[model samples]
Target: MLMFASSRVGSVSAGRISNWIGHRYTIVVASTIFLLGSVLMGYAHAYAVLMAGRCIAGVGVDFSLMIAPVYSPKISSPSSRGFLTSLPELCISFGILLGYISNYLFGKLSLKLGWRLMLGIATVPSLALALGVHRMPESPRWLVMQGRL
Candidate 1:
């Protein structure tokens, strides 16, 4: 029962994540799926109710990934910065792995903490990154020397 719920959220999260970051239409589609899932979860009953939670959880996962790569270049520099910029996606993959590990190892946490916490954890880094991004300058930068000093 719980396993079904835990996995429900992870199922479609990948495809939605892929789509959401790529284009405007993708976001609309993702949002629609997310909204549908939220509605389903809210009023769910039977095994199917858990299923909707899964769907909602999956879309939440997508939301976590939606803006990650795009946030990279805007935060990084020209040389070696792309590597640093890649950290967002890198960390995302790592978090997925960690979540998998958690699910496998922490059965108690899964039952007690619930799937929502896992989804929230996945979102926190991205949310923090987004908040940090707002403080950044939206400008192209270069190393320049104005005077010999």
Candidate 2:
């Protein structure tokens, strides 16, 4: 899980060797794939499918986990940067909390669909995150670097 985050986060930093071609797009695409893969993994009955889904999800997780810290500070003001830096840790805890709550709830359902439901539940957040990104502004630092500021 940590390694997956590393990959996602790492991409958000400098990106890739061929990123000069379209790194930002690649990261977004990869993130989407990861999110979808995670949801898919939960429902996957076959071991191979589950593993593949996990791997894809890991890639996407890597993209988001790595990207935030890599770019957040560059755009944050010094006065509030410390708080901003803590957001990732907070997010991690929140995610874990949510997962535990959800798993506990699903575990009580006493049905096959219950397990699947728990895994598929992640799709909602992934969709929300994707939409939120589309609605929000690009990084101010990135804009400034591009001379849009």
Candidate 3:
């Protein structure tokens, strides 16, 4: 519930920030936040820390969701726009399926280690996103809007 609340708030803020700083940096920011959240959750010894981590991660999720749909169409050719726009949804579903599998596999470990490993594993993709965002082209529409192109 807290996650959902924070996410809703974050989505609005992310949209504004993306407009100001551009979507590329917004994605990097979100990925960095997600990495932080994963580390916090992984090392958490207290309930408060876990909740904090969850809130941060929720915000990151919202930021990504808010930006991607808007950004995708701008980068894709008209003929491919429909497929490209749907890719995010497909990836999200695949991620959920992967999460379920990871949960089951990690659950087999000792309780203390299992949960930590499960949460910490998220850092891999988050880190990849943070690094990869730098390599991606900024939305051409955004560049034009900003008079940079």
Error of 1 at 79 (Å): 2.1
Which lDDT value does model 2 have at 44? 95
The TM-score obtained by model 3 is 0.95
lDDT of 1 by residue, 1-149 (tens): 65455444444454444443332333344445555554455445556675755656565445545544543564466785779677867886897789888656555564544544543343444344435545554322211121222
Clashes of each: 1, 6, 0
- Residue-pair clash count for candidate 2: 6
The deviation in Å at residue 101 for candidate 3 is 0.5
Q: Compared with the true structure, what per-residue lDDT tens digits does model 3 show for residues 2-116?
A: 8889888779899788878898999998898888889999999999999899899888888899998888888889999999899999999999999999999999999999999
On the 0 to 100 scale, the lDDT of residue 142 in model 3 is 75
Off by over 4 Å in 2: 1-14, 17-27, 144-149
Q: Candidate 1: where is the Cα deviation over 4 Å?
A: 1-46, 63-66, 108-149
Global CA lDDT computed for model 1: 0.50
Summed over model 3, clashes come to 0
Report, for every candidate in turn, its global Cα lDDT versus the true structure.
0.50, 0.66, 0.90
> lDDT at 144 for candidate 1?
17
